[model samples]
Target: MNLDFLLCAIRELKRNKRRTLALFAGYAIAVSLLLVITAVTVFSKVHQTAVIGTTGTHFVTWLPSCGDLSSLTEEELAKLALGIIPEKCKQNCENCTGCNKKPKDILNEGFVINTNTTRLLTIDLANEINKLPGVRNASPFLMFRFRDPTDNKLFTVGGLFLGHLAVETNSCGTNEIIEGQYLSENSFNKVLVDDGYALNNGLKVGSKVIIAEEEFEVIGIAATGADPVKAEFYMLFSEAERVINRRIHNPLENEANIILVESVNGTVHGQVMEDVMKLMKNDSILTSGCYYPASKAIGLNEKLLWVFIVVILVSSILMTVKLQLSFVAERQRDVAILKAIGWSNSSVIKQMLSESFIISAIGCGTGVLISGLLLCVVPVEHLLGIEMSIGSPFNALSMVAVVMFSVFSGVFSGLIPVLFVLKKHPLEVLRRC
Candidate 1:
């Protein structure tokens, strides 16, 4: 471990420049690949998870089975019927006197309607929810179900029902206004349609469109590739309310299908989801479903990191074994002399192990630096399908993992050869030399 001994080892390695270069090069390449893989894996997992959480927030919804117009839970039969029961009535023995049967549970009945009654509550509730801890921002939107006048067919479009809330820039991440201008909260009687939807409907910005009975001026064209159908229409909240008729009871209330909440960070998704579910449960609302970015993507990135580690370990071990064996063969005479002179097996092993350690430190350091440079130049999202932002704590952790793996690999590789050399008999080695 002394400097003189290390210098001697270095000098010896330099004598066989080609062999030294080969070993160093092999180690460097392996370390570089390992580092790159680790960094990319970590970056991808963090990025994709964030994307998924954001997407989940943008699409989160809460639906009530018995769609009473109020946020409060209901227990009475008339309230339940008025809330979600269809306009069509049917006779049932449960509701008749002298009938021993109980009424069918509203929870069991699959009844949902798109109503305008909940438009006011949607905005109020969203604001209230946003004020809670871990809440980022929430906006209320209106969904209208009406037959398109031109086609006379049932169609649904999401309208910004009410509130001064604006689609904050980058709110949808990849989805944004691609052409024309986005609708403002103050703007009224104007609509923004998704690009794909506009194309299908043969519509363009500045065109007049009729929904329900109200006409709106097309103000912008937007694109949300994630959902071709859902992204079809974006309008002012006021416009949405007007189109659905502010006077009408929101049919969708008992069917409360829209309420999206975003958490500040992706890592908080689980916590936020739990809180949301708790709120819903306390309110006696049933959460139909929750979506976050694909967990599969994060899992896949982790698996790839494991695969890379295995590959690096296997390749590094093989190379280290080959190099050590070659060293032992070439220096057999020296090793025998040291043993003959009463040098303990431990000392000799240390010298040989030290040599490998020195080479490994250089190789691994070079590799890590190379990997860092590559990470800087590479568009990680393009490579891994997950966005990577620099300066994240996750990135720092990945770097630490890479460095630790490299040092561990070096020590482990060196130990394997040392063990083999220590088992040889001094006399036998000398006789062969």
Candidate 2:
């Protein structure tokens, strides 16, 4: 009996070709829109994660070269002042007593370590940090201000060993590299120039630039926009040591003032940072986990997109309900005749639902096919400025949910009006018609 009713519903739909097509088109459009939006939302989330991972998933630790004067007692200050005061002390030492001594006195007294523009941390310590649990990678970096021997101009150079993906990517990530290639492990005296700096200096790949009286080959150009950790020139760690050592006339071997640490994941970031803190007392740590204050605009836009999706879904369901109500109204005479012929209310309702289900299944299936094609055609990089395929973001579970929701909306829309019409007797329905 149920099979007969279902077949009857199918025949009725086949006879009402125009009405069936109209309902099919409506459902298909709605489901397609939902699917496209769902795909975009998923891509947006992935883009956000990539952005955060690139900029906010690591931290840098560095030891200050000089101790704070405010933290020192008067006795300690008096002893230090008894020797030669550093040239930098003039601006920071208002409360210190007057003292006059030779510049060599301070170096002979061993008051400060590596006073020639370096704070001094060891590469060995960075290696130790890399061994900590949850620490994805730890890289030693030397940031030096090198004077241009030719022009007598000053330029800041950042030196780091290549081959480590995390820190190397953070400094000059693949996306940021505009020309040439990234630095290799053996690339000594070869430098990566910032795009702006390259332009200003008229430098390009294979161009030679003099730094610390040494000529270096520019191997790549990087466009690091608003990145906090950047320098005019980037070179190998050993090369930078030689540059600084040449200027200072003191060997700076296996020395690094900064250590860049990347955690394996967000869940382990805090523990990794804690362990790092315990390892280095009096060291300053800067975390890159929090989004910059300028990203509030992006956050607002994401919220707006979510709200728009909600509005679209609600309006689509409402429109479907309205269409189904009108469809039920127009078919009341037919429904009355079926009831008069001894079709039970349950049977009638089931047949109508079967029609709704068939239409929705076909509509949703068409919609899914169309959406899949659209995803393949669209490039997410063009839309979001992040390099990724549009089709790759749609998780299997998410797509299943979308299809299920769309079908539910269709069936529920049809059921509402069907129930309303079934409330009346066949005589009442006939009288109304």
Candidate 3:
């Protein structure tokens, strides 16, 4: 605990040069492995986020089940329609056929979708959700039934189109256009079909598909390993509005049946999602609403990285403990001599701990420095195949934890063995000598 004890520990360590070097090298190797693996893992996560569209973002869906379309009351239908037809007055009702009832005589029991212009059911709630303070951004996910021009059949349920920021792709990124070019950002009557859909339907770039009676040419085919279940079509934001506008002339064009709320910060995401659910719940138009769970594949490399770190640390601990116990038994005479002198047991223990601490600290520092240099000098991003937009190899928090664990291992390994040796009588310790 005092300067003399510390000096004595340093002198003892220098005397045991071989042991000191071995322990230092082992600890340094363990720390370096931890740092490099951790650095690569962090970069991989960032890259995975880019490759998978929506990444960790969750969504709350409001999918109106049209099976009970007939059950919706006049007021409910009116609200959902968003001014597609006259809310009242049978006199102006275009669907009023063969009924001789006057405008006042006809009862406003329920409303029906014309189903002619657009078969898609889009309920935009972007404006309401966007108002939430926690929400970074909110996009409407609209799905509609579009008739395939060749087959004259409606596309399956997942024919969704979302408002996306850009129409581009990288080698391992989302919105990957494989065969053809993406749709023009400002263009209408253009669609981007998924690879699976195009292949199944014998559709290709430049093939025209009919949605709500209008023909849209397939401009591109996009693929993403993240989204295994492909959509029938992906269209521009402008084109989606264009398609849905005919069926429902809503005041808010951004009204999406399914809302994709993005609040990436994990701490706020739960609260933000709660706020979003509260705001959109018990609505006049919604039949049902629920959170859309995200699906992402866990990378094998990431799993293996942690396993390796654990294995390395465990091995290091076992080796250190074994070596320290052997070394202490060999030095029993020194412990006997120290105890025979005026040195208290606590003072000897403190000196031993200090020696371990210094060794651990130096080794940890050397390893971390080497890891940083390796990360900077080696093209880690290229080798790992994930861009490291972040400058540091090891995250500050992770580095702190690694250092602490390493120091603790050294102290623990030395303490247990030294305590066992000190427990016996000085004469008994010297008996082996």
Write down the worst ten-residue block by lDDT for model 3: 97-106
Best by lDDT: 2
Candidate 2 TM-score, C-alpha based? 0.66
Give candidates' CA RMSD values in order: 9.2, 7.8, 8.6
lDDT for each residue of candidate 2 in 1-433, tens digit (9 for 90 to 100): 3778779878998999999898888777777777777777767765665554344557777665455656657775665455545455655533222223211223322111123332567688889999999888999887766555456565677777776655554565556889998788778779999999889979999998887567889999999775545778888778877776555424565667677887775546667788998887643677764534324534555677567667656765675666666667778888888889998888878887787778778888887888777767775456566676545646576667667766767666777766776778889988989
lDDT of 3 by residue, 334-431 (tens): 87888878678887788777877777778888888888888888745866765446666566765676667676776667777678777888778777
Candidates ranked, most accurate by TM-score first: 2, 1, 3
Q: Which stretches of candidate 2 lie over 4 Å from their true place?
A: 41-59, 66-119, 122-137, 143-158, 165-184, 188-234, 239-255, 261-279, 283-290, 294-302, 374-388, 393-399
TM-score of 1: 0.61
Q: For each candidate, what is the lDDT? A: 0.55, 0.69, 0.56
Query: Candidate 1 vs candidate 2: which has greater TM-score?
Result: 2
**Candidate 1 local lDDT, 172-271, one digit each (tens):** 2224678778666676777777686688878897888876567878878877654312535667555654555432333233122355565564445556
Worst 10 residues of 1 by lDDT: 93-102
